[model samples]
Target chain A: MTRYFEDLEPGDVFETSGYTVKKNEIIEFAEQFDPQPFHVDEAAAEDSIFGGLIASGIHTMALASKLTVEETFDMIANLGGRGMDDLQFHQPVRPGDTLHVELEVLETTPSERHSERGYVTYEQRVLDDSDAVVLSLRMETIVRRRPEGQTE
Target chain B: MTRYFEDLEPGDVFETSGYTVKKNEIIEFAEQFDPQPFHVDEAAAEDSIFGGLIASGIHTMALASKLTVEETFDMIANLGGRGMDDLQFHQPVRPGDTLHVELEVLETTPSERHSERGYVTYEQRVLDDSDAVVLSLRMETIVRRRPEGQTE
Candidate 1:
């Protein structure tokens, strides 16, 4: 069932399954997108503040988005993302860490100019196995509205 | 010559070389991190609002970060990213489009608690070959302070 804009209510919550962070994957992503010592070079990371190789924050953000799409947003009438706000990286994600996402619908506003679409704001918290939030952000997306009188 | 916190001043601007966006890379990244049909499937994208496959916003963000790190941040005594705010994607990034980044230092603040480090805030604008701003964000990062009396 496709979830339209009207189907998402503020305070609605969703959880996604876990994804294990791999050392090689982290290095590969970092090399391609970040390439910082703490994220790519294990030996150099030992001397940095992290003390070990860690996943790039960008990688963490991507992982969070992936999980949300696979488990929740894939079923929605999502047009695309509008933007993000208040993006924060709270903890370093290590190679052995397993991560999951908790998504809360924060707001929904029907587009004044477009009758067929609306905006949905969600607070996404990416948490590690220990329940600590590794990353958090507020994401705004454009979603199609259900046709009038259509009950699916 | 590493650029320490003390070396960065507000209004310092750096422009990066361009990166050509490839169709295969876009699909591969979307497949791994954001498997929305519009981002990963070309045929499905034709029917979507965009009318074509588009790079995932997360992928664009990563590309911006990569360009910054490679062209500018690599020479800084950087610790790691703190966070980002006001992230906006103004336009959809298409395959074959080349992208570049412009980073402007916005603020610098010495860490009161950690004297050896401080924070540098920058406004990053990711532009395409047409000179349109596709993505923009405010990024904050921790940077090591220059050692006292070390003028090299």
Candidate 2:
């Protein structure tokens, strides 16, 4: 889905394929990056406030970032990103959790720096199998404008 | 630093030791996660707008997350993050870029849902060797309140 800035309208919603979090993968990612007990030690995590092994927030973010590109977000002309805002983690993502993502276009602004590019801000939500929103944020992306005669 | 919610003042600022980005690490990260052409393929990246290989934004987030725990954030009371807002890729992170991070406490709000915990928002910035901000975000975290008679 190579979409251009001009092709995206505010209020457009894009959904992604489901991704499952595995227990080992959670620990692996945590050990390699986050390394917190709740993330790396299953037994310790069970005794912690989280009640069990939980995926690191960065892992969740990586999944979201990957889905944002795989499901939509025109990659060919995707200039890059400005940043994300108002990020909230509502729930801890556990192993066996199957996650789905939704990206809703919130606003679009023509680029002041380049006529060939513009900024698209989206509200990205990561929902668990139970449809609970585990994570949400407003992500701003730099996407290219459509060139003449190009269709995507 | 064992910081509790009450210990985190809104104006508090913390700096982190640097982490250098490696070319192989960047490719490995992208291969397992993002897998974008510009992120995974060096030759493809050379022809892209970036003009060379670049680290995935998610990779940068992961490094920042690791440093947050290793360098500053109070671990014992550090409940996992809620989410990040206004995450921006201010500059492309290239191989060999030595990155330093700064964390500034933005605000603290006691949790209405749970009296034992509160939310602390930090503005996290990753600056390259040149002192240019490459990535920045507002990260929200849930931290436990100090127990009675606890001293740190």
lDDT of 1: 0.95
lDDT of 2 by residue, A9-114 (tens): 8998989989999999999998778888899998889887889999998899888877777766534367766777787888999999999899998999998988
How do the residues A1-152 of candidate 1 rate in per-residue lDDT, one tens digit apiece?
Answer: 99999999999999999999999999999999999999999999999988999999999999998999999987889999999999998989999999999999999999999999999999999999989999999999999999999997
User: In model 1 chain A, which range of ten residues has the least summed lDDT?
Assistant: A73-82
RMSD to the native, candidate 1?
0.9
Worst 10 residues of 2 chain A by lDDT: A71-80
Best by DockQ: 1
Residue-wise C-alpha lDDT for candidate 2, range B1-152, written one tens digit per residue: 57789988988989989999899999999877787778989999998678999999889989887887777863437776776777778889999999988999999999999988998988999999989999988877788999878887
On a 0 to 1 TM-score scale, where does candidate 2 land against the true structure? 0.90
DockQ of 2: 0.68
